[model samples]
Target: MSSLEKLTVDKRTLKRIIRELKKWKAPATVLLSLYIPPGRPISDVASLLRTEYSITDNIKLKRTRDAVQRALSSAMDRLSRMQKVPPNGLVLFCGEDMETHDFICLMFSPPEPVPVFFYRTDKWFHTEFLEEMVEHEETFGLVIVERDQATIGLLKGSRIQVLEELEGYVPGKHHKGGQSQRRFDRQIEQFVKGFYKEVAEAMNKHFLPLIEKNALKAIIVGGPGYAKQDFLEEAKEFLDYRIRQKIASELIDVAYQGPAGLRELSIKASDIIAKNKYAELVKAIEEFKRHLVRDDGLAVYGDKMVRQALEMGALKFIILDEDREDAEALAEEAKKYGTEVYFLSDGVPEAEWIKKTFKGLVGVLRFKIA
Candidate 1:
């Protein structure tokens, strides 16, 4: 058995999956969303997949049943032999045909647990939940700086997208005589000034637009020492006050300054990253709570209430705890009712509060649901 690193589904991944779903044309398809709890045995999920496959034989749709079964079997075999299932959970899609063994197997782990279930259908794959996951993602700009170099990137959920790298000249202070050293220092000061100017320009060009557009929530700056501080000071005049205010964290211990630096910065600023990622979800939960307190009938909670709102075509939006096993079904129903869905990640404090208070399901209604 081979273990694979579990990856969180990001915007790029979700977009690619959506493209694949749009292009997928098959006689039968099997879509399995399995929840792999942390520290739980993989055999449990594998056995469940096997049992679910066994029941697919009774599907009266003769033309597609066999193909669906083959796809399900392939999915089961793949799941059973895995040494590690994603700690978050896995969603696997398999397309099979009896005539040609050209099967399409696609698997990705969500950033949070998705509802665990299996569905064999000839229609297009269910992806509302994934779309919701992508919607809740908050993008942040990442900057890692050194005296002579800097790296800029975008962080959306668990994915790090490097955008640009900058390098400049900063002369060393090691001249022989005092006069010579003074001259050398003057030249170095000039170079550092020019370097900071270029850095400010890069920041304005690459990051400011996203901040202005509200696509990016915050910026995390990190570096080895005073370099980061110096760069921030120089760039401050160029960046809008609003954008500068979005600077959530500054790290002084990052030793690298390129792509590796961006990665290292991500690790060093994990707390800020998590906070940015869940900030929007937390805001949405807050709004839901406001509605609840006002008794405006604009919000509803609990599994039963949310499902009822969905059935009545009254849901404007649905917020679900990703850990809830029934979220997938409810999200699918919400989609049919033309309601948008958002998954509340457990990493956020408000999400845990919602789970404890509302049984992890909530809805904003288009109108009173009584």
Candidate 2:
């Protein structure tokens, strides 16, 4: 399948571009944003820009007219070099930096296909379409159930949202007499069944809409001991068939039952979450850790060492905590060497660890620089 159909665009690069473009602005409506979807004829866009350049002469302010014409010229010049639209399409943002008053033009193929053709001139670069590409619209349903308590949550992007919490009462095993003990056991079983049913009802209520929207990717069910197993068994009857079908084949064993259990379930279900952006970030951090533990020359951390490696063209991949003041500068420098760059979000434990231990910047070297 094409990258557009799979929706697999390099999100890290897209985010970096978005962050960079958002900073450029003009005092007047002189900033130009153009989006050309795949299959568009570059010549058509060039002709349109030429017409726009001609129309700029009618502007009341000379400065605004000059800025608008310059931005349009920059865009047209960019399109002239492109033989055709890229697989994912192209985006161009050209304007005057309000602070520096320097002409600025940024162009790239977005990670995802531009859904429509658009062109606009505004004070700020149009980023709404790019923002949509980064939104975590798809979600995973999290259900952690045990005998006494259960928690249902949703893992959308990096955030986990608790949807419902339920509590139940099931008496422990009885030893009073044979008949009395048997009756107590049956009562306990019934209570457990009722709890499972309650959990299922909540799931159906919350997840059915997501399923219908095709936004629910999967459901992960977990808890301590046989309770999880029992739920899966009873799921055939208690859970909606749609939810039951969505349940991941791998059920996790978690010690806690409430919000804590949901967190545990997310970590344990790494195999399932591997496709997620947060999971990918975790994996990258883990890889860096492995190289560090091995004491291999391939691993380097801290600003000084990472910069040295980048200068030598030996850096293969670099991870920078987004909170670091110099992250954008370091990322730009790394890009000069064609190195892969990843910016870790603040507040993530692994990201925080990198910030605290490695001073927020790290790199994996292409070769031993020493």
TM-score of candidate 1 on Cα atoms, chains taken together: 0.50
lDDT of each structure? Answer: 0.71, 0.81
Q: What is the C-alpha RMSD of each candidate to the true structure, in Å?
A: 14.3, 12.8
**How displaced is residue 131 in candidate 1, in Å?**
12
Error of 1 at 238 (Å): 2.2
> Which sections of candidate 2 miss by over 4 Å?
1-10, 132-138, 141-235, 238-354, 358-370
Q: Write the per-residue lDDT of candidate 2 for residues 95-204, one digit (tens) a residue.
A: 98655778888777877788789999999999988887765344799999888788999987655789999998888768797888888888998898888888889899
- TM-score per model over all chains: 0.50, 0.45
Candidate 1 lDDT, 267-307, residue by residue in tens? 87888766655675677777888898999989898877877
Candidate 2 has its poorest 10 consecutive residues by lDDT at: 2-11
Q: Candidate 2: lDDT of 241? A: 90
Q: Enumerate residue pairs that collide in model 1.
A: none
